[model samples]
Target: MNATTPEDRPFGTVLVANRGEIALRVVRTCREMGIRTVVVHSTADRDSAAVLAADEAVQIGPAAPKRSYLYPPAIVEVALRTGAEAVHPGYGFLAEDPDFAEICARNGLVFVGPRPEVMARLGDKAAARRLMAETGLPVPQGSARPLTDARDLAAVAREIGLPLIIKAVAGGGGRGMSVVWQADQLLPAFRATRAAAGAVFADDRVYAERFLPGARHIEVQVLADDHGNIIHLGARDCSVQRRYQKLIEESPAPALAPGVLGRLTGAAVAGARSVGYSGAGTFEFVVDGDDVAFIEVNCRIQVEHPVTEMVTGVDLVREQLQVAAGRPLSLGQDDVRPRGVAVECRVNVEDADRDFLPCPGVLTEFVPPGGPFVRVDTHGYPGWRVPAEYDSLVAKVIAWAPDRRQALARMDRALAEFRVSGPGVRTTRDLLREVLADPDFRAAEHTTSLLAELTARRSRPHRAG
Candidate 1:
């Protein structure tokens, strides 16, 4: 509650208002920095690794996110009750919720992120697109505002030509998004996307954009402090995705065109500074050849952030905490020297053969990969039960090396070493392995559409037999 500078204010205690590996990730950093941590969790995560690692753990509610993690009031009450000075909404639930951030500010608890107004501006896809355009950055041609109705949407689609995409103005991670490849698909796609947006984000605002199916997904990691210092920690390619969800990510975007990374990095810092941003954020773009178009800004630390950290040697979460406490960035742009290539594979507890359905069960046998250049971030253990109520991601396995080739080889070895087994348990490990070995992926010619190709060719069920 004390409005003091970061250097004078002791950020001694922090309440983690989320669960899973991200919560554990934050807790680890807080511990290393000598900051006390309180973890808020649902019944599903009572026995999770994050809870065990925290200085204190509080049961907020049941397994349902709405009643627990997403319930801002309960989270705020818990922080106040625990005497925590700040609340860290580790990605996913409430991580990008501007209202929650404002609520934290109003209740005198530091939100370990950007200001609420800044989050609102960047969180809205359409608004972010407009902001990016104003910065003189290239943005995709699309609806400047939320389309009025299906007729308006149809008209815009016709003008933009076929194969355009309808996106929820308030959506992310591919949810509330629909691709319309033909004129007949416009109405259905628009209405469906609107309904999805309302259901997920409680906002039915929809916009449209030209679809670039083969473009690579590149995003730059950005850090900004309260003092107006913003810098980028290079870029990462997350083109290996399925259903708009990234499954694999790599840093330095192997084989990028000359001067592209520099441009992307510069634009990202510019975008962040344009909004007077703070804390950790990402500027996502769709890259086609040398032309890059801004897609959206992820106003929170991302799941694929480890790839950037692996190469930059910057602990983004640590910086985020410091920035939230009003500290300037520990490193400047000149100091952010990215070295080596890093690849990350998200291990999900899903049946890749059955259209990637969630296959949750006890992990009777759990073994994570490890080596000189490999790092695994997970909250699961041998006896831990994979909860069906939450996201299927169980762990993130990352590999780093001096070059892309060695990084890929190291990732393959790490995947081979990762083991998980139980009834009804199927992971994306084998699928990721197959994708990594594909000739197109090795050549770095894969795009956001690569998952569709892999899915079509999937013939075997990946089971831990």
Candidate 2:
């Protein structure tokens, strides 16, 4: 690999348009690359770690996300006012919004992701499916476009069979999705999903696909540059999820048939090149046995990125910044080699026993685990209050080892050492431990339904002897 010189630096100053761990994560990478950072936060996060670590900080709005992080105009204004040369929208909020990218471009500030046009086309799940299918990627059997009405949805659902998934065209992060198993339950599920989609994403368009009950949720990480260079960093297994939300993720998906990984990575790279995609993105797929089907693409840094970094030894954020600056990828496909096994667990401030309900309060004590091959990405600290206005994820604990068995053991040890407490505060630490010890997970045979099944077993009533 080549060293980045002063001239190679993408932007002298970058404005981070998000909050919590992702904001802090971006600031850390920028500092290492000799770039100054400006972070915009709501009033509730005035004392956040990202704000404290940044060279400059500004208050954008109140606690509400809509008035703060999701408001593109205010964030663009901050970047311009602060003299930031670029804006990095980490993961959520306005990360995938093409209009926000265009606004940044119109103001002469670089948006550290794909071009606005490409983002707009791929941001729509239905459209992305069509494009990927045309590019020779295997797409699930479903509607090729957004359903027009109840009749259209029913027609597609019938064609796709009884068990199908209703997904919002503009949905991500597990919201606006429902699985209908019974024919009688189709319309109600459609109505509820559409309502939730409109309220959350502000777009109500939806489509249906055949649901895979016993499938592994795998995603390939890819990085592209404007110079027509793209490479896959490998794949992550995000099968351990509840309510379609991923709780744990690991890289180099285990127990795959021979050549499955290669096929998935090749398809991802081809799909990215076909759409002229740039920056860091993820291609999510559902794998049932030896068969794989394309789902959607995440056109930004993912939450489980650390797992990829652990095994690949690549700084994805650094690559994103360099690509945004019109630089070709620093390395090619031949230079990319993944080693060992890595696992990451999202430690959220939620009570797992109470149906994963969010528990927010002041933290009386916060101590993350530390040791060899263990990384903790978080914005929490002692005396810092856990705000209910944002996502419940307080920290991410990652462990790497030479093999999957050791990695799981290391993660369990790290989770055991994680000490966090406060008034009315709870976390999913215990639940994650149980998952790490599951028999099916140990054999790498677990599917996306593992978490739900675990919860169901826990909720069953025991007969008295």
Judging by lDDT against the true structure, name the best candidate: 2
Minimum summed lDDT over a 10-residue window in model 1 is located at 1-10
Q: On residues 340-428, what C-alpha lDDT tens digit does candidate 2 reach at each position? A: 99999999999887799999999899999999999999999999998899999999999999999999999999999999999999999
* TM per candidate: 0.96, 0.98
Every candidate's lDDT: 0.91, 0.94
Candidate 2's C-alpha runs over 4 A off are 1-5
Pick the TM-score winner: 2
lDDT of 1 by residue, 1-465 (tens): 334444543388999988889999999988878788999999999999999999999999999989999999899999999999999988888989999999999999999998999999988899899988999889987889999898888778767787888999999877899999878888888889999999999999999998999899999999999897888888899999878999999998877889888889889988988899999999999999898999998888899999999999999998998899888989998898889999999999998888889999999999999989999999999999999899999999999999999999999999999999998899999999999999999999998888888888785566896
lDDT of 1 at 188: 84
